[model samples]
Target: MFKSRRPGLVRRLWRSRVVTESDGHSGKLHRHEQRSMTHTDTAPGLTGEAGDLTEGAEREDEEQPDDDRGAMCVPEHRGSRRGQESDSRTVTCCLFGEWDFRPRSSYWAARKDGAGPCQCAPRRGVLEEDLASTAHAFLKRLKERSLDALVKAVETKGGIPGECVMVPNTELRLGAHHISPYYLLCKLFRWGDLPLSARLKPLCHCQSFGAVDSAKVCCNPHHYSRLCGPESPPPPYSLSRSDEHKPLDTGTSIGSVTSGGHRSHWCSVAYWEQRTRVGRLYPAYEPSLSIFYDLPQGTGLCLHGHHRHGGSSSSSVQQIRSKIGFGIVLSRELDGVWVYNRSQHPVFVHSPTLDPPSARGLNVKRVMPGFSLKVFDYECSSWMAEHSVKPESQEGPWDPHSVRISFAKGWGPCYSRQFITSCPCWLEVLLNNHR
Candidate 1:
């Protein structure tokens, strides 16, 4: 939980991860000159995955076709506070902010078949290492064909049409066989524009489509709406609009947004990394191989970090020596965490209870930059191998602790990389701290 402390060097240290404000002087003037060169130009509206794009305004109900009129009636009435499960018709999807962290287990017996938890410290490697053969093959195929061909194949498989109805296979969820096509469809369709994907089981709304006679079904418009309604947008977010606003000038290095500016939009970010445990893996602490995915060739992806507030009270410089989490959204007030894509898209991650000791910790905080992040947790990694094929396929002695990020020029663009790899920027930050 974050609370404002007194303004001083101590405060600055806590906010170091956040982006700085422009003082409205030379820093501001210089940024004004290079603003165009820095921030990526945003595309306002383009054809997205499976549905019509809704601009700033809500879609008009009058425009619905007779066949689709019954769709989304419930979602229209439902407020934003509700979770994804509430709407039977919808599948929750997010780019960043929500992190599905593995529950750290007590050390388990190492598998004799060389089956689980490799005994290597920082045991795992990057997603790239695990899928290097697969991804490389893909690259070669892309070059053999035209970019259009590559885009088409990715679109067909990943579902880039309408609302991005299909999730692209990247290093993250690659081996996750539980992924359902209907679930993917629900994620792709816009709640406001189409029928909720038919995958939802418990048929709650048989009446909307007219239930057959003799089958007395309680038509739940509530559940029906989720099955056929407007797709919910990711969460909305706000950058701090207060006087604490610091502008990021051209050369003013990028940092976290929650540092001290006014709150902007309210979208949640979700992070999905392969779960693994310590040692007995490639470079341990690196994300599992399945986390990596080749981005839709031309598209760009960006990683936004939200930093946590140090503490409520201010202390002397010596007090500033403590370490808080890295570029992640930290809030003392709201249980919900949100992230903003540089392209202006917002994602919302649900954090029900803040008991880190309890099972209900916020999902997004799992990979905090400087907190107790274990490069390799052997117990959890073993569990992941059980689900993957050729579990021992990834061999040893590879670099696995880099953060790979891809940036491009579109709003809501999807980028996929493994978190296990140590990114240059993160390494630099670590180096600076040591210095």
Candidate 2:
């Protein structure tokens, strides 16, 4: 399980190629191993372990010819979400053993860590949106146009990220954390494996003007073109400001989650941020070239840090508890600054004026080492108490504020003058002022 954290493991998984006959017996063995382990049980005894696995392997060997027969064929329901509309239709595969739909080696490692096999859950929202018709089609489009579109978009909107910002897989991530759209797009499009003809130019560039002018900038113009257009609006959700330790609900519609054995959902109260389900994207532009580049700088809105391209700047605020601390990261790449807790356990942020009981909390859990769960209780807790606002009376969704960024300068303390709700520059200044 710890191996998953190693960059080498990920690189190896990403580097594997499709097994073919040219490789002879070893290739056949590997293919058989992949097929057989896709979903075997992992309870204990050899039958539950090795024996069942072998039977599955044999079955796969028998089925290999059928796959070869239809090697060029496409599965019937490859990229769809048409039928299963109800909660009952949300099918979850039983916790599969390590081999479930993966090569034997992957199965062994995953089983050891107890990570459940990937399910066929109608694909996630971002994927569905990107591959609206088909994953293959989406890949084709990305290959055909995303790079050009990204280049053109960056030429227009300066917010485009460059080579410096890391893009993670196609999952929602926060600005304060590592991971960026560049990483996701490359993985999804198999950009790394493609020949030079298919490779897109790196988006990073030198600033044309500013004090840090010529400073290297991360820009994916194609995607950025769509972002700053009038069509894009702030995501329609906001989370409570404090750490509330809410349980994750298994049910959909209501936001809840599972941890260890306990399950808790965010409070039924529909806060603004939670309303915008993190990790989802809407088609943001009307596909254009000039419009993408002509847009003003700083028009790119923050995704409250929940964007595929985690933003670029580290937070200006850092509050240290004896054991834990919290900080906010702001990036011109994203609109809202991210409020992240450095604590292993849940740390609360609150308004100073509020009474203790009235404040809300944003409970956090460790998703990755150094990264904690981004959502929590609605209370304005201690984390925010040092800021100018009195903690007790600060009812959140946090109060809306504006930011003023200098196009030539990029971003600064003055950016807070504008009314962007997601960035916590005010809190940073408030704490700095007190200090």
Candidate 3:
């Protein structure tokens, strides 16, 4: 079974592709793997041990058509929650995964890490009021155009993503930028940091922006996807504020982990200022919040102190502090941990689920202000932590249990802020073995 499986057998992770249905829609359903991917368990395995995974050892990309899976081309139909279908009901296929015919390979293939399928739920209060200025504006735009109803219909639909919803072909402006209404909706609802290189293509056999007879433009979030390309690497994670670099105190219970036992607390939390520890480590129990930041009300892990950069410029400190307004609230939910970004600026996250690295690189999960993302997978993390190759270090190729959140800044090859330590205000969320 994917879940409850033994770890330590590191695999190749993900490869993208699709098989045509031999029956009817064979020609329409072409493969969309773009030398790209998210995760996959059905991917082939390594010939040797994990360490032997080198460039030459990698295999060539090829499409394998599975008739059994393709036979599921018949989409089970039902009435959507918010509204009625446009013209034709959206097609949901087991092969086409979730987000509007997006291949399952584009999802987090947790089975690759000895975990279950991708059920990563969206963060709560995504469209509610109390968002940052930019986010509020986006929400207002959606509601104004009555596009929010369409998005909800797509999201809450029973089968595949609901049918396409469209808007005027003209550009929608937010602040100084002119943006595609559909692309922006996808960014808000589906992919948090939808890549700049990605362009919206209508679902296979669907019409273009205006080609649809009645629907001017297709606005369905899942109806479009980014062209296949290599994802950019995220910034490196740093632990300390001092010139002397120190590894993050990942709050590992070495004895419990090695002995295959459990920790006393649900998680151990720490607030960081550059490299300096803000205060004592906080232990979180059930029913209580795991970690929180600079909130207007009840506080837990608050961001304070200017150990380095912010200390120099009071105005800069205030500017950053303003961005940190309303901070974030992270809590342990059903089987995973969810983070709601209540701050004005975007929050960048890197956790086991977000960054499963094989040394090639990783994409740091970005949660825009007002939205949320499942930052940690508890079952997967606990299992990996107990069975990890290196139990002591939390900053391994991928630390399954701990999570890093950067406030307003993101670390990566793409951004100037390339390390977590360089980020002015950030938090280190280290989970305990509480499975």
Candidate 4:
């Protein structure tokens, strides 16, 4: 029946039937809802079928799990992604090649906290300021202990030959050799055996015939002239009656000058003596060996023993029964000192002057008992002019040129200040003066 009806009548009947069915289930649909439904119904026909769309959606859900598993397996990818995000915020600062600078929020806030990018630099500057202040205070205090005051104090309290005394609350430790103010006063003064204290007497100048007094006079000629009388006119006086009254030959040799004419005889003698004294105090060349010890020789030896009868027998017994300490054997051919530890215990040796060039900066050495160590090649000369002492003259062919050794309760180098108070032992070597 519907097919036989008119086509327009059939379409109108179908639309009326759909509208009537929708109105029976619920109220009339809103204009927006109706439009969305129309679009959904036509979208599949233009793009794909509903079954195809559902299948694609299910494949996408399954691929998400695989992607999550891959991300879990390779954590670096995730970290790189995070790093990229962080780097996007970072601003690099190009200073020097060594510096890695990044501007952080905290860096910008540093000005509020009174700090800089390099906080340690400011802290170090503060520390330096504190050190400078401390050093200034120390120097100020040191200036209070004047040399004149120190000399007066030492004169009031005489010191022993090897003893050392430190200024109270100071780092200055002065030895007996440094107890004189004259050395500090003289511009050309050098260290020598002739101490200023030995020339304190008024007559010491006259007794030494001006040789000793000239040093004092040369240092302060005007000051000494007032104390020891006017300087004697240069050697031979004029034959004139007025000049003859002056005893110009009092301190000089009579033969040094002739009565016929004036000569600088006393001045020449004085100059020679001064030069000799200086040469004796400081030699031009260094000796082959220098000996140093803390204890006296023959200290631990059994000199008066029953085995002292035969020379060979005594030597053999002494080797077996002698108490161990230290001994040295110096050979002229070797041009060095062979130091041995005679003690059963180990001994440590330290010689800044004698250390070998190949020692790789090592200065201290240890030696076992019955072992010998050679040191200081003969070719080496002393570069330390201030510490070197001239060799003393001795009457032996095999004797060393110079020897200086010190000892303490234990092993180590003995400082000059501690030499007296540290149970010190000493050894000295005297060599032929001609060398």
In angstroms, give how far residue 198 of model 2 lies from its true place: 31
Q: Which model, 2 or 3, shows the larger lDDT? A: 3
Query: Which parts of model 4 have CA positions greater than 4 angstroms off?
Result: 1-332, 348-352, 355-365, 382-403, 406-424, 430-435
Q: In candidate 2, what are the lDDT values of residues 1-435, reduced to their tens digit?
A: 343333332232222322222223341222112111212322211222111223223223323222212211112221123444421222212211211334453322323322343332222222323322232332233332333444333333223333232111232232222223333333232221111111122211212111111222232322211011112122222213221111111111112235665444211111112112233322212110010112233232232343223433332211111112122112211112122221122222222321344444221111111121212222233344435554343345543121121110001122211222232222211111111
In model 1, the runs with Cα more than 4 Å from the true position are 1-130, 141-326, 330-336, 339-435
Query: What ranking of all candidate models by TM-score puts the best one first?
Result: 3, 2, 4, 1
Worst 10 residues of 2 by lDDT: 284-293
Provide the TM-score for each candidate, comma-separated: 0.17, 0.22, 0.37, 0.20
Give the per-residue lDDT of model 4 (tens digit) for 306-394: 22222333332233223223332222222333343333333333443344344443233333332334333333424433444222221
lDDT of 4 at 177: 19
Where in model 2 is the C-alpha error above 4 Å? 1-133, 143-435
| Residues 278-395, model 1: lDDT tens digits | 1121111111111111222222112222122353222321121122111222211111111211111111111111112233212221121111111222223333335432222223
Tell how far residue 38 is off in model 3, in angstroms: 33
**Highest-TM-score candidate:** 3
**What TM-score should be assigned to candidate 4?**
0.20
